[model samples]
Target: MTGAPIVHTASGPVRGSWRDAGTPNASAAYLGIPFAAAPVGELRFAAPVPPEPWTEVRDATSYGATALRRDPGGTLIPEPPIPGDAILNVNVFTPAVDDGAKLPVLVWIHGGGYTEGSPASPWYDGSRFNRDSVVTVSLSYRLGFDGFGYIDGAPHNRGVLDWIAGLEWVQRNIAAFGGDPGRVTIGGQSAGGGAVLTLLSMPAAQHLFHGALALSAALADIPADVAKERGERLAGILEIEPTLAGFRSVSESRILKNQPKAVGGRKGLGLLSGLIDDGLPWGPIVDGELVLRPAADALRDGIGADKPLVLGATDDEFTMVADRAPRALRVVPSTALLRGVLRDRGVRRAYLRANRPQRAKGSAAMVGRFVTDHVFRSLVVRVAEARREADAETWVYALTWVSPTKGWACHCLDVPFWFDGLDRERVSDLAGPNPPQSLADDMHGAAVSFVTGGAPGWPAWRTEPGTARVFGGHPQITTTAYDNTLALL
Candidate 1:
């Protein structure tokens, strides 16, 4: 089918192919266009430098360069090849914008452990959001070591650089596609959600995005030294030094393939996942230039007081990570690990007194619950409190509708419901036979509302318990669901 008339991007004008699978009835369309300089060869581990503007318009109909591919079996994904180097790119979906007025903008970031996941993943298709009257956009960023990785002498968090660049492209050109530059809302699940949290605290990111929907993440503190060591190891495997000049001499795919092995033993690290947050050669840094401070700490200090925020998590978030974690955390099986973990958080006494697992499953569940609450739930509270610190609008949520098969509501389970796509996965089918159609409808509508005006029919979270807005089964605006879990945690 013929696509929309060619829209002019800042670099040049381009066109898109019309969609055969657009919104249920209407013809929502897609346009994949490049936005930055290619990061091949020498540009490998450097901070994403800007691309030169083009005189000739590039065809934006096809998906631009995706960093690289990944094997979901491992922790990190490999960087993939794009059409050329122009690494900055965005895929957009819009309802026909004939007589234009400003439309809400939604920029989506796909999740894959900061290394995996592509902007073109089918699950992130923007058709539905487009039909709902929001301008939907997805972009390609650096993956694995190409985007993340802590290497000495290398710039930090190139992935974040890529995201900011995409936003810059949107600000300069999305008006052509019928979107408002001032009303952009960035959001995503898992790592993408984590990115949203990071962007929230970034001063460089302040004016670019006005709102964010963090689906199931707030992961932004990278251990610099550890992460840099990881990058050095990745460098060692490729027989290259961990410096920018050394890494630039290697092949993209080879460098990507050697990613998982760079960290050595998974168990030896003590954590199931090992993403370093070291300042330079690793994760997001506290560099005076890039990241200013720990995002959570900044939020709790009220940095992003004006922007609206959405916070939530699935009940079984641990199920996916714990599918194998049960056997893992259960290792130092003497309850020493549990005690140590709590003590580290400075709440061991309170946790032990509140938690008394009486059965094996309860014991396992307790461990899983502790991890979930410590990592995610605490972050959720942290973000909301940060929003509250600034006296900004913050809505708190708990995805209480547990997946039927697994009692723990687990991570990523909320994606189906949030997308109103519960029927798309077998797990969702098991989570709830018919699943509550109202859950998706309400949640999606609430998202649209939140992006537009800072709310979704629930009260803002106060420093209280059981007051979370549940996202299922008539979707109650209540509290006290996981207070006991918090106490035990």
Candidate 2:
């Protein structure tokens, strides 16, 4: 505790520094420890391989390389890309170094639509969780075409394989960091949240963690035929074969440049239509192997029935996008705009009737809410409905706290509250000044309780289907939290 805290991992001894040293909230932070070998050369598109052992104590004071090569400007989360070959790494924070302490663990995955995101973000720091006696970890994996794009000879779902590898490392070495491997909980937001759900449904991944937390999860269960078509189109654009060898011949920059065209990047109205028609283009594909089916289907078939889960999304996940073109959106009637996204007349009428309040907000708000319901909120309901008969409990919640600056309880607004990271940098940009610390205390407390005891301080969805804890101004339980989204199903 005096010098730099050093914990001996299976691979080697790692030296970490302490945060808030000499304070009650102080914790040891082991940063940028590789869980897998550098994915370069022959290993670039293959399954993750264990990292090589080191004799000397590796300095883990700084974050390791991230899969994202360039900065994606204007993101809600500050996912700064760090450049290096060893991108498959993990960052750990612990309250103590004693192996016998046997504290619970929270393994978080950062969200960036599967194309971008870094574990190096300040919002993801685990000091608060560590202070609550939970060992926390953040990890990085290959993104976009390099990780999920289909190639003839390469392994499928390499990003998913990286997740498994990271969890495997935790299982083997977390005890040394004073964490109980059996109490591990996997949590994430956006694409990262989708990853948590995907892992929960995976038969092979059931042993990695005992609980799950999915916030505004966006699943990309692309069909095999669609994946192959996109892969072939990408290869054709680059004038190369769609084989692993041909793709390996091209530079990562070239692939990054041309990958968008393969997925049909539309503009304006076409963009909205394209999104509603086709979900995320790059993510975990159903290969009939590791990921045998769509996550919801697997969950319905009882695939993660034994594990506890907490899932939900904010009230206005992406309505702020509508605020960008208020003038144009104002002129378009809500019904006319809804036609572009929801083709079914009966379903559209039902959805509109269910969400009369959103419809009154104007066409832009109505369309935006529709997109949010279609992509995120509805998934939460679907997953809960899928696990209705399962033995393990499922708790649902909604983040209804509206940001004064953003004007809506938009996406990424709930993350800071969940992590108790309202004080972290850039949070004010989204959360506004003087965000409530009481909300953070309640949300973070529930998360800590769930990670340690396998249940959030709320009634399970199974106990009363459609029941959900609402986190916002005057937090309370609501039975019709996702009533509007139910029309879509």
Candidate 3:
């Protein structure tokens, strides 16, 4: 049980090194293990296929290549970019190796809207989950156009198909790493969380995992025309047709070079501010087969109805937009935008009439609040209610812990606390040098309990006056999640 640990997967044997080598009970890490063949050349836009078998024990100690994407703006947190074709990989962390432990597993999908992000990011280490006797897995799915755009010859939601492929890999190989495939929980934040909800609505992904957690779930979807328009725009930029063959003709670098143009020329907004502004420019689409319908419709229609679920959001999920932008440039919901949103969601005209404002003019904070409630929080609530209506076990939560420096519980502010990653210098920078360890203990403990036992250490969500476990200065269950925001939806 010394040197690097070796275990046999369905494909072949893999060699993994200790993640925190020399540290007490150092976890064994198997990184960059390919779950599918390189999606390149003729295979570029097809569904994932099993990786070519390896006769040799492949090294699984470092991250694999991240999918091709635009570089999000600078950040204290490190998101390393390794480029290559065989990027569909997963990193596994286990408390012990070759011991047949069958520990609970938590498979995490990183968030960067649908356009950018990598599990290779340093903030996604799984050692803490291993410390809690949970086998943690971090995954890298296709992002941006390669992952989600609507092309003529490719299946829509290819990124989600990547997830299904990864889960199928877990079913076949996780046992060798002391994990129980039957006791798996899939979770994510922001766009990743949205993916979780999309998976919940997808029949193809229903049985792959036992439990689910969606943090700051942005339950948003784009119309087919919108997805097609972005794809055509990208093809136009590449001087080709909007098809698989068209994209294949160009280099990934060239495709990325012109991707920003598809979303209004990037405008220097961090991590997907462009997509976020253009209403999720690229993501899950209504392909009529894979997606079937919009996310909300699919969920309310009883997709993944029997599975237990956890839905959560930050108190000010979009409030940081205010802090980042000037008052004049902040996102104040115009009457048209608000009315269109309500109309699209099918909100009752009576409710919209009573709550709709003549015009909103305010500071960045006010604008942020409006966007947070309209875009993120209300959607979280709607999904929770949908799950409840189906008599499913569902739990809701909100992170109200404001950062001392940032002063708002903005998007992605909850990642560190959930993974028990507060000690990482990168996380320390986001949550403050001295963030609350007790909160991390409670939140992470709840996540572990849910993944292992099918309950998130709380009662199921009830109808009317919905409740959510508030995680912040004073953690408690309260019926104040939406605060009558449903009426304004």
Clashing pairs in 2: none
Clash-forming residue pairs, model 3: none
lDDT of 3: 0.78
**lDDT scores in order:** 0.68, 0.91, 0.78
Give the per-residue lDDT digits (tens) of candidate 2, residues 67-151: 9999978888898999889999999999955776889999999888899999999999999999899999999989999989999
Q: Is candidate 1 or candidate 3 better by TM-score?
A: 3
- Shift of residue 419 alpha carbon in model 1, Å: 2.2
Provide the lowest-lDDT 10-residue window in model 2: 266-275
Rank by TM-score, highest first: 2, 3, 1
Supply candidate 1's per-residue lDDT for 417: 59
TM-score of each: 0.86, 0.98, 0.90
The candidate that achieves the highest TM-score relative to the unseen native structure? 2
lDDT head-to-head 1 vs 3, winner: 3
lDDT per residue as tens, model 1, 154-204: 778788888898899889888888888999999888778888888888888
